[model samples]
Target: MSTVAIFLMIAGVFFFTTATIGLLRFPDCYTRMHAAGKGDTLGALLLLLGLALYNLNDGFSLAALLVSLKILSIAVFIFVANPTASHAIAKAAIDAGVRPWTRKGGKP
Candidate 1:
C-alpha cells in the first residue's frame, strides 16, 4: 500500500512538472490552457488519491475512511471544476479576439 501511494505521488509530481514546462513552452494561450487543464486535473487527482491511501496505511478506521472520502471528494471537485474553468477562459479569450498561434508564413 505504501508502495502504491508512493508511486501515485511520484506520478502526480511528474505530471505537474510536465504541465509547468508546457506553460513555459507553449506558444499560445489555447495550447497552454490545454496542457494546464489536462495535466493539472490528473495530477491533482493522483496526488489526492495517494494522500488518501497514505492516510489509511496506519490501519482502516471509521475516522480514516471518512477522511479519505473527504479527500476524494475534493479530487472529484477539481476534476469537474478545472476543465470548466479552462473552457471559460478560452471562450473569453476567443470573444476578445485572441487568435491562436500560426506559422510565420501564414500556413497551418
Candidate 2:
C-alpha cells in the first residue's frame, strides 16, 4: 500500500510538472488551457488518491475510512469542476474574440 501510494504521488507530481511546462511553453490561451485542464485534473485525482491510500495505511478504521471517502469526494468534485470551469473560461475567451496562435510563416 505504501509503495502504491508513493507511486501514485510521484505520478501526480509528474503530471503537474508537465502541466506547468505546457502552461509556460504553449503559444496561446486555448492550448494552455487544454494542458492545464487535463493535467491538473488527473494530477489532482492521483494525488488525492495517494493521500487517501496513505491515510488508510495505518489500518482501516471508521474514521480513516470516512476521511478517505471525503478525500475521494473532493477528488470527484475537482474532476467534474475543473473541466467545466476550463470550458467556460475558454468559451468566454472565444466570446471576447480571443484567437488561436498560428505560425508566422504558415497559413492561418
Best prediction by lDDT: 2
Displacement of residue 5 (Cα, Å) in model 2 is 0.5
Cα RMSD of all models vs. native, in order, equals 0.9, 0.8
* lDDT tens readout by residue for model 2, 1-108: 999999999999999999999999999999999999999999999999999999999999999999999999999999999999999999999999998888897765
lDDT of 1 by residue, 6-103 (tens): 99999999999999999999999999999999999999999999999999999999999999999999999999999999999999999999988997
Report lDDT per candidate: 0.96, 0.97
TM-score of 1: 0.97
Error of 1 at 6 (Å): 0.5
lDDT of 1 at 54: 97
* Each prediction's number of clashing residue pairs: 0, 0
Q: Which residue pairs of candidate 1 clash?
A: none
User: lDDT of model 2 at residue 26?
Assistant: 98
